[model samples]
Target: MSQPAAATNAFLVATQRALDYAGFAPPSPGATCVLVFDSTLWNTHIASVHGLLNAVEQARAMRFRFERDREPYAVGHAVWRIVLAACLNVPISAVPLVSTASGQPHLPGTRWVTSLSHSGSWVAIAVGEADCIGVDIERSPSQMNLSALMPRFCTPAECVQLSGLPTPLRETRLLALWTRKEALLKAFGTGLNEDPASMAAAENTIVAAPASCGRTAVCHVRDLDLPASLVGALAVPAGAMSHRLYWLDRCSNDVYGCNSAETSIRSN
Candidate 1:
């Protein structure tokens, strides 16, 4: 084969391999698929993944000012495109993802609602058929002054509940609650522009929507099962729906090799 043809063929093979490793199956109708991956695992393929991004994403990646931040942004967005392509049944490059004024990413004319979040080295993406959807993953901090933050984001009732817990448990629950609130706000496409303390994120229950969100609508928050160091949550408009979780990781023996493990999380 000619040299250029050979390179193109190799690229195609590698792309298929990565997709297979990610287990890029479409979410079941009316369900969301949440994929969490360590962006650091894609470090070796940064150049290749960077190539998958569009101009806007490329410019955004360039503005990161630090390599550590840039790599994950590139890798995360590349994986996001891969997931979106699978959902839309299109090639990765064809996914027309755009960000809203508040910075929530979505497909312009599609019914699919999407959200992305990254913390430390982990990135999480959510795709589903819903009125709106949001997902967030956060690495628990080793130490933080919860007392200084609670009043800013926690509701009065949440403060009372958390105040009764032991220190360690309170810290963990605090992060979980933060993720839930973030996810809910992102789903509304208002982000932190609305006060996070306005609504309480009680698990498995419908919480009153913020002023930016329609007064009649409510949000349902559910915590996600993640590795001990990380906490995650998903939010959607109040209703019945399902979600599937997948973990994408690199093989220990080969930096270029990839694999995925499916994690089943029961609904609340």
Candidate 2:
């Protein structure tokens, strides 16, 4: 009989290809992590969740918050906590999963900050000691009404640039543009309420913050080299410094890079 799939194999073989594009490197003085989850692995991990969290507070929070939820979401929540613990070299239970008034997550007293994104069978989390970070990923939007959606979010220039693309390329580019805009909004704690058209940032456009905050906040964004089936973007404050990437399940280092189905596991 044929052997079963690798217990930790990614759902898409193409995802492996995407990682090559991600540009993984080792951690520096300020740590950064990219936690990728396999759909096939989540089911197995959930049953083993019995002792994942390590602190009384974290344990209590999981019991009331994460455990009560259903699969994938719950599993993803657990993974988020796990990523925090893994990066900090602390017990999963010792990591305090708290959010600010704007709903961005933080480690409370620690130097690490984070952003999460999930699409189809994949979940990705980027953590660093930068002022803030936001990451997003999505499946190719072949099913969406892109023509209808572009104007709502794409600035005129962005629209024209997208329009000039071949039919297939346009959709991916637009979705990627939207993904970067979403990442920036998440970084700024505005979510989608802020107009994406004005906020859009492309590979060439790093985007400027609003008139508020003296516009001193710098947004640095870039496209990830992911599979054609997916698109993604990473947004961090300009002074974030260097970053590294890792695979969560193996705790192994990862290097490179996609857009739209944004963070399925993140509540805010």
Candidate 3:
């Protein structure tokens, strides 16, 4: 776990408000909670590293080619351990992990759905009972020029919204759409194989039954609140639709609450 709580608390509070502004509902108990962290936190909780890795034998036995890449690799692994430990209310050493040929990390025999994403010093993890889930955090300070990328990812309506927004909002709206599409893609585990703009999922609220599941499959996608410099989104299978944002820096504490005034939903 991250050693200090003060910084983590402040970051989480700001992120919680960001989530509220993006039309996120007060986290439901059954939906998994999303936890955000800064990459720098990977160094502070150094003392717990060994135990955290050993708890999951698969992680301990892993191999890497370059020594320089080890730290960042370990950081991602450690974040997963820390988040899983916090969620299970258990010690980091007790968490177990399994690797699959598909490369998506799994929790041995458990049904928990998880997704991890990091960009520009920030890392986020979303866990829950949903059969499939994806979470993404994007830092927009250095994001690409809006005009160059929108045609590749945005639906016609999204593009119209982009053109209609005030100059100050153009970039922000673009990032929001990108993050939402990325989250949806991650949830499907389909990577870039399918067109994000054509997913046909509702803008932030609709859960559609995929044709493959005999019209019974469903996935929910929506935006997340984060610091002004960052944007985020979450996706979950309909089986588990509740969600809450959490701060897990110390591995055990509720740093934010859902008492903020709810904002009206924004239409894309």
Candidate 4:
């Protein structure tokens, strides 16, 4: 086989092995599946995965000035396509993933809704049959200027709640709150274009759409239990009662570089 063809075959085989290792399952009615993967796992296979991206995604990945930014973007989108393909039972290239003007991705003409977020080394993808869905993952920074950001994103009440905590606790809580609000905004499809302060950050609470949204919506936001260094959240229309989370990391065997015995599936 030609070098390019051989690389493509290797990626395809690896993707299948990963899915099989995870015992991957599609999201069902009333539930969403959030897959979190370490993008670095694909570092050695960048060429193989880059071939999986569409022209637009390829151009966007190339636009990144540094390999640090470029590699993750390619790996994230490639894995996203793989997951969606498995869910729809189609070839990876056949998944009709498209982005809105604001860059939130979705499956055009399909029942499945998708939202993607990445932070530090991790990339998260949420998929389900909800009217709308959003997922966000953020790595906690060692330091931040909380005073400068809190007012911009937090409501008066939220600010009060966060301020009452000690500095360390406050910073941690704030990051968690930020993820929830971002997820909710993405689910509303307005992203940060809408005033984040207009929505509260309380978990499992119904969030009303901001006046600028020009429509009424009740979104449910929940905190995701992730590794200590990372905070994540999911937002879906109220109808979606729960979600399942799967961590996709490299296994020790390292041949396929996709499976992980440590992979965990959590439902809530």
Clashing pairs in 1: none
- Tens-digit lDDT track of model 4 for 1-268: 9998798777777766766666678978777888888888767678888789999999999999988888889889888898899888788879999998887787888889998998866899999887888889998763567656999999999988788788888888888888999998888889889888877878767777777666777677888878897889888887676677777767665533333222122223
lDDT of 1 by residue, 1-268 (tens): 8755564445445545655766667777667778887888666556666567899999999999888888889878887887798888888778989998878887987878899999867899999877788899898763567656999999899899898888888888898888898998888888899998887887666766677865556667788878898989988767736677777666664323434434333335
Model 4 residue 19 CA deviation (Å) reads: 2.1
Q: What TM-score would candidate 2 get against the native?
A: 0.71
Predicted structure with the largest lDDT when compared to the true one = 4
lDDT of 1 at 166: 85
Worst 10 residues of 3 by lDDT: 256-265
Candidate 2: RMSD to truth: 9.1
lDDT of 2: 0.60
lDDT tens digits, residue span 1-268, model 3: 4554554444344433434443343233456777676645454433334434553432543554553344444555565665576556566567765654445556766657678887755778777655677788888754588666767887787777678777657887777777777777767666566676665444576455333323344577777766687788887765563566654243224322332222222233
Q: lDDT per prediction?
A: 0.78, 0.60, 0.60, 0.80
Per-residue lDDT of 19 in model 3:
42
List candidate 4 segments past 4 Å from native.
255-268
RMSD of each: 3.2, 9.1, 7.7, 3.1
lDDT of 4 at 182: 90
Error of 3 at 170 (Å): 1.8
Task: Tell me the lDDT of model 2 at 181.
Answer: 85
Instruction: Give the better candidate number (1 or 2) by TM-score.
Output: 1
Candidate with the larger TM-score of 2 and 3: 2
Q: What's model 3's lDDT at 141?
A: 53
* Poorly placed runs, candidate 2 (over 4 Å): 1-26, 50-70, 212-215, 247-268
Instruction: State residue 11's C-alpha deviation in candidate 1, in Å.
Output: 7.7
lDDT of 4: 0.80
